[model samples]
Target: MHEKHKSHQVSGAHKWLKRSVAHKMFDRVPVVPDNFTIGETNDFLKTHIHEFETINYIYITDDTKKLKGILSVKDLFRKNPDVPVLLQAHQDLVVIYPETEQREAASLALRHNIKAVPVVDHEGKFLGAVTGDQILEILNREFREDVLRKAGIRRSHMMMDNILEIPLWTGIVHRLPWLLVGLGGGIVAAGLIARFEEILATNLILAAFIPLIVYIADAVGTQLEAFVIRDFSISRKLNFGKYFLKQFILVGTIGLILGGLIATVTNVLYPDSRIAFIIGIAVLGAVLSSLLTGLLIPFLFRNLRLDPANASGPIATILQDILSILIYFAIASRLLS
Candidate 1:
């Protein structure tokens, strides 16, 4: 009989794992109708509190089973016994729908700093509560998924599955798509450089700064991409216009400082004021353009329902390189000519 019960329990857990929070996995903790007075609730809790997995908060509902408020156990014990539960209950409730994804429900709880989240039906009827223990499990699972995704691993693998156990061909298949796209971007970058061949030939010294411009711009872009990826993962409602304006101003200031340093150094070394001036302006433009590209591309990807991290790697690098080259040579051509 014990073995049979254990088998049933395992099957129930597996079924819950594959289903939503409404699937009887959540805790149906103590609930009191809002009409109950403090005295009545106190008597009810004394008898029934032990039945719940957690008695931190008691859900308050109306006759129709609609969620009305919540009362902390601490407040319940301290309040006047004759006071109505409604007077002492916290009416500003944070609730989740039963159909909500378990991970999303967990995220909401974490965001609001709530110990447990109440589940409600479409009509706002109380269902149950997703307790803190279940939330911990959901958060752990999501953390593993996020780490694997950032490492470019496939989601088909289980969180506890050993990476070394995966077949080499399966790993290759998961990684090959991005690599091919990166190869194509490299080809495009090569084409862009070839188009600027005349500027390179006329001012051979300009070729010397190509790697410098690309490297600095790539570095700045990578930093911005990292910030965007972290921020967007937590909150999707970022104000893009305000964010873009702030980044532009910040990058512009950095560009001016960098440009001045380059100008001072090149003016002393080159002995040609015109060439030094052109290089300084080109540096400023390249850096600003790279910063904007980095800030905007991630937002664009996010809007298109693609992972912004995809903007962080080869795609961002190649774009910054190509744009930096174009901006540098354009300034050089106008000033040096």
Candidate 2:
């Protein structure tokens, strides 16, 4: 990341490696010559430890700074320190380009258990290292951003999807089905809520949780929608049956944990086991059902030759809300009536 390393930039001055986040994230590493003996490397390290930003691995390079190998601190002070450092350092290494995406770099670091990913130029010259601490921060930040983006808020670029390029009538046709379906679904939802009017009056507390149940279901559906859309962009032939079966298991487990925790907490706070049981059971049902709507709507749109993201994103969110309400009230009425 320093000015001196700028000379090693690949393909003139405008290469991806020089411009990507990998360039900014890398830190100055402790480097040694490939021909140096272990004893000499140790002496150099003792004197220059403070000069390095990350010392997780000692990089071995040639006079031209072409990375040759690497060794841990333990390997540097092994029983025989007189041999050339390359004799002990690992040569077959996992590395990334300065142009590599931050998430990808973090993945490589985790997959190899290397703690850090070494950044190298096209010519195999070392640039620097993306350290362990940096990797963790990158992953954690991505996770939070992903959760917020998929559930809490959504950001979309219709231009990227070329929605404007399509003919107006055709676009309308693509979107119209969901709008009409949502209109009908909305009417059904309102009628259903009205049908539950007596249940609500009998236990007014039941009304307070309508938004929470709807949000929990919609949030889960939105996350799956975002993830599946992204996955399709990356690999179009991704197996949905595999994804479908896997979600049942994963979402089922999540439902059990969340349901039981809420049940336990509600019973303790409200001292009403029946309300707790009803709320917990309703939550589990909503979550499991949301998973189905999340996956199904996207595929349904794709089958109809429309953009799946368009359907699952904004147009069909009402589907999950409707489903959640149906599940919640159906369970509540059965138990209470």
Candidate 3:
């Protein structure tokens, strides 16, 4: 009866832990009581050190188990053994609450450059610490999630321990959604170009520049999307206004240089100042619009609780292609008329 009761309690704890947050991952390492002097700490370590797997920093706590400060093993060894442990302890505590998400707890450790983060209750009582091993696990899980999400795969697929063991149909189902969306987007882009038939037919030269405009716009948007997705994965708090301003400055500069080069080349090859002017202005407009579209699309998806990387790639590319065609034709029609 006693063994059964103990097993039941363990099972109950496990169930409870599953519903909890960062507290569930807490590690119960031995903590040094704040009142212990350096000499006493040394004696305690000599006797009780076997209880711990590894000791990087000694967590100093008060009698009631309230965290006081921390002392590194390096600092402890360098100090006089007769001195109080608190004297050598660093008071700047970096702690996380039990309710914090595991990812957030790991991110905190990373941001602060610490091996582990201490878990505390609302009242500041120390519960346990999140070890470096746990942090590593969380990082690996997050990395896998980002990769799979970017590939347009469902997060539930992470449960499949072996990738090669997954059924062929399951893989196709996961990949087919994005491909279908891209197909629809391609149809829409084709229709958009068809609407500009008169402009393309009137000036065959404009048709030649269409590929150049679309390619440059897609390239610039892809670059911005990759940067934004990576940054958002690590830290969600991005200053959109400032980021947009910076991107605008960057895109504007590049557009001018690229537009000038294209205009110069077009004038030399075609010798039509009107055509050269229209191409240059259209290129500048298409690039600026594409850059803004790339930045905003990811942010919109992120706001909608969608994975920015998954949606940004295909959608941004399609949108850039369509917008570049529209901008290029609109400018040519206006200038050449």
Which candidate gets the maximum TM-score versus the true structure?
Answer: 3
lDDT tens digits, residues 153-272, model 2?
Answer: 333311223566877876665446546766877888888899999999988888888888888878888777777655654444678799888877888887888788888888998889
Tens digits of per-residue lDDT for model 1, 1-337: 0011222011233444354666424444778888899999999888876567678788898988899999988889999999999889999988876556676677678888888889887899876788888888877876676565545555565356555987888767766765676678778777877877887788788778778888878877777777777677666588888888888898888888888898889889888787788778888888898765677877888899876765666556767888888888778777766
Comparing 1 with 3 on lDDT, the higher-scoring candidate is: 1
Global CA lDDT computed for model 1: 0.75
Model 2 / residue 159 / CA error / Å: 26
Indicate the TM-score of model 2.
0.53
| Tens-digit lDDT string for candidate 3 (1-337) | 0011212011223333342335334443547788789988877766766565346677888877788988877778888998999879988999877666677677788888988777777888876677888788887877777666655566666554464887888878877776687788889878877877887788788888889988987787777777777666557688888988898999888889989999999999999998999889988998898665677877888899776766564556777888998888888877777
Candidate structures ordered by lDDT, highest first: 1, 3, 2
The local lDDT score (0 to 100) that residue 37 gets in candidate 3 is 92
With a 3 Å backbone cut-off (N, CA, C), the pairs that clash in candidate 1 are none
Runs with alpha carbons beyond 4 Å of true place in candidate 1: 1-27, 37-53, 74-82, 98-107, 133-148, 154-161, 197-212, 226-243, 250-295, 301-312
Model 2: per-residue Cα lDDT at residue 87: 85
lDDT of 1 at 96: 72
Q: What local distance difference test score does each model get?
A: 0.75, 0.73, 0.74
